[model samples]
Target chain A: MVSKELKVTTEAGIHARPAAAVVETCSRFQSRISFIKGDIRANAKSIMNIMLLAAEYGADILVEAEGPDEAEALGAVERLFAEKFRQE
Target chain B: MDGSSPRKVLRGIPVSSGIAIGPAYLFHPQKREISRHPVAPENVEQEVARLKRALERARKDIQGIRDRIAGAVGEYEARIFDSHVLILRDEEIMGTIYSDIRENLNNAEYAFYRRMNQISDRFDQAAGGFLKEHLIDLRDVASRVIDILTLSDGGKDAPEIHHPVVLLARTVTPSELAQFTTGNTLGICLETGGKTSHVAILARSLEIPAVSGIPWKELSLEPGQMVIVDGNAGQVILNPSLRDIKEHEGRRAAHWAHEQDLAGLRDIEPVTSDGKYISLAANVELPLEVESVLRHGADGVGLYRSEFLFLGREDMPSEEEQYQAYRHLAHHLAPRHVTIRTLDAGGDKPVPALQVDDERDPMGWRSIRVSLRNPAIFKVQLRAILRASAAGNVRLMFPMISNLQEFREAKRLTEQAREELRAQGLPFDENLEIGCMIEVPSAVLMAKEIAREADFFSIGTNDLAQFTLAVDRSNERVSDLYEPHSPAVLRQIQMVVEAARSQGIPVGVCGEMAADPYLALLFIGMGVDELSMSPGGLLEMKRMTRAISYEDARRSAREALRLGTATEIHQWLEDKFRDLFVRLGLRRGTGAG
Candidate 1:
């Protein structure tokens, strides 16, 4: 398992679109991923779960993944957010 | 007979919904023409019976629409109609008209008009302007009643647009479109409406190509012929051949694909080909729109308009109610920064709960100014925002700020609010980032002094451009003067960006300019740290941001700043990025291309 705190640079934190992307990204991996905001932890698969966090621009969130593909999951999630939500 | 002239298809801006390709079913409501009553023949009681039956049918029809909307739009929102219904059903109103029609031996129409005069007279007796406007929505209610009374649905027999037709009208209402069906629809054209109008909203939602603002008489259209609607381009072609239809269908497909392409951008990181990151967020009006912002892949809500809570309500929202609204959003956007502006009402937007003076001079007596004048309302909002700050990450913004003094006053008030919470033993975010909107030209000119006293600056370009040019964007005659590309407006925006950058304060543009794909480059070039707008524009902006490099943006900004006139700046951008400009679909020669 690989885990680290990532700053949400996308102006809006885990908004539905990006959450959908994250969920899409997580589902692609054999690994299970989760996002933690303070005491609340939401399954990365659920867009509703992530939006409930109400994370705004520049908010730091905890990202964790467990699987052989955990490294890929972490790198993908971190890059998606750090890139500031520009849909390419 | 010269029967071969071909149909002249007219193009117009569509402002309402449901594409009706039927022969222009125009119902232009006007003041009823009055005529001297001629003595009627015997059996006038039967005439009264006919009028009563139609009135009852109209009442039933309104009730049916009300019930359907209640069921469709959800019971809560349909509640707004409950007031209209009570006004419709009030026995006092019916009894007055019913008695006059029977006892006075007056015609039903005359009795109705007389009853309307009484209501108007009563409203005229009232003092407040707001009250008068509400009554004014009723001013034409009698006319509507009359129109419904006279409506025979004539010539609506068989499906109107069998082959193809270009529907043109002065203006269409939501009620008119509610009865429209897809089998009879092709495209819609209206003489009025823009992006915010119901026509545009419904057209976009229904995936129909509709345009508004074209005078119907300008085009000579024939019946039972083909036409094409290039709504995105705001163009229409009349009596199109099969070849033209094929071309138009292709264009429609591409437009739909472009929309889908933007939707596809929902999950993509807004990184450029060169990979410089820019923050993208949405300016939200309600929590329900949060789904759209999320769908657009915005980082989070950057600006949540708090004015809507006060709208249509007689009393101010309770502190707990305000707190709950903010708390729900803040908690929902946990870890994301939801920078909510303090009630942006007042100025042009009036809320009766505040009872602000309806002065000829509303400039200074607006926004945070009004809130500050009435601390009771200001404290209710401040406490709510302050309370919600703890749920997750939230930032507070003050609007229409002109000088450092206003900033100081607002800061002191926010501090007092925080102190009240502490005294009450309530938890709150200890470190809250406070910002002010640079909407006024004076605020932009004095951005440095204000930035020194503030944590951040969000430029409200809608007002800034309008104020700078002294042009009301709402006024169609002079809206052309209200251009973001204007050298003067661009400079003001640049000045704020530079001032904030020099002072090390975070800055953003929270105006329609932030949403325009064509100007996104200019904003980045000007060095704004963030761009905020309606969630509807977020994904498209995200896609545009990822396509352009910051270096190019900065270069464009510098070049645009040196221009002399608004036209000159626009021309320069056009000449510079003629190809890219064309791709962006910005109008050439004028603002609306």
Candidate 2:
């Protein structure tokens, strides 16, 4: 299992587009990816689950992946967060 | 032809004048009654397989729409559909639905519907409803899946019109109305909507006969029933007798001939016999109506209700979407002004995305007030309008501006939008004219103050009459009291026109009154510069403008202004113009006249 803590830096936070980017990145790998914000855990592969988190700007979310390509999945998710979901 | 069946006649308000004799097509787009039934044990696997197939088909459907939107609009807009596709492919939802069918023996549609409602409830209870927008998206995706499931089970889908038919609906949004091919839709009958509603405007521009205000519950109509829509008489007849059919058939021919005669007046200027000119324009809702406006030789578009772009959709329109629509209008109607009214989403026009809860209150938080409260949304619209101004002649008008403060705030936001565009190096027209609607009585009282800052004014007589009389026009009990020709309404209009004159700004009337020959003559006599209405009324108004002398109209207007009551004014105008109206064919000539 690979785990990483990421901060939502985008202005509007992880909205529909950013959440979609997270799900798209997570779906590519054969891994079980989940995002934990405080007490709630969201399946990163499901866009609705990620959107339900309602992680606003500056909120911290912990991402966890477990499976064959767990390392690559975690890395890709971290990169998405680092780039602020590729939003200007 | 149907002598055995009794004929039923229904009365409504004639919005677009013509005649249509065809079969009825009842349009019920969003019927949300989900049937819940148990599946047999032997049919469990079959039901699960059906659910899977539906999911796959829904995914493909959304993907097709995404690709098309990406090609037509932009990637930003198409990206929203990507989330819809993902929701369709979500294994969590699909696995739950499959299990519901296998274990609970529930039908596929009910299983999916139950799970989606559960998910929607969860989103609704989310922290402070921040996920409200996402809830809308979720419902959108769920409805698409449900629609597919229902279709496969021989349920209702969007009715496909292969032959000419008169569409019957309780009310239809512009997008829903756009689904049917223009050639197939011979006319339209609605249970709701006023003479100036978006559907009425679209029907007129398309040259489709339409009537509204008929009660839907009273229509007990079957699909493909023979119906005659007499738009000239504001009447619909179902299962007509042979003689009734023959009479309507003859009238239809005469109506067509009359329309052809009116077509000849298109190229002529709308100048009075006294050589006084009145600018005749069209009030358009959709970009598709621009062709009709030009074909009818309108001076310009006086009231381009921009809220149609926001209606019939789950989400608010993006800046790019709004920009493209406004730009299309400005580009096509270059040198002819397009007065785009900013989001008038409340009262009769309810926009769900704007969260306007009190739609019944016309004086509540709506129009300019709604825009002022939500600067983010307002700025996007302002910026788009400004961007389109660079393409051609575009003017911005604010609706429901009751006070000088509201007008100033709207103007400030518009200026802010201009500055933002300037910073981004986007070109816009610095001299773009800004106008305010004189709808409420307060606006009329403060017209002189608002006129100093506003470049122009448009009097929305429908709201003005309702507000001035404190009578809801839709309310049957008080509708009779809501008179546009009331002396109080005319005096207020005179005040607004005089205020505009004092400020050296032009004032126009863009309301139903502008289409009435008598009221239009009063407005012209009051020194109103422009009269805009539905395109169907443009040629008729032009004909009226040419027949009467401006001196006579002005003198009659002055004499009628001193009338004591609405009945007196109405009676005097009717008596004074009876001979001229009949001579000019403005009114039907009875032998007594």
**Which candidate wins on lDDT?**
2
- Candidate 1 similarity to native, TM-score: 0.60
Runs with alpha carbons beyond 4 Å of true place in candidate 1: A1-88, B1-96, B99-231, B235-252, B356-364, B581-593
DockQ of 2: 0.45
Which pairs clash in the backbone of model 2?
A: none
Best by TM-score: 2
Q: Candidate 1: lDDT of B518?
A: 55
Off by over 4 Å in 2: A1-88, B1-7, B29-158, B194-198, B217-221, B587-593
Error of 2 at B229 (Å): 0.8
Per-candidate alpha-carbon RMSD to the true structure = 26.2, 10.7
CAPRI band for model 1: incorrect
Candidate 1's error at B179, in angstroms?
Answer: 17
B363-423: candidate 1 lDDT, tens digit per residue? 6566888887887669889999999998988899999988889888988999999999999
Q: What would the TM-scores of all predictions be?
A: 0.60, 0.72
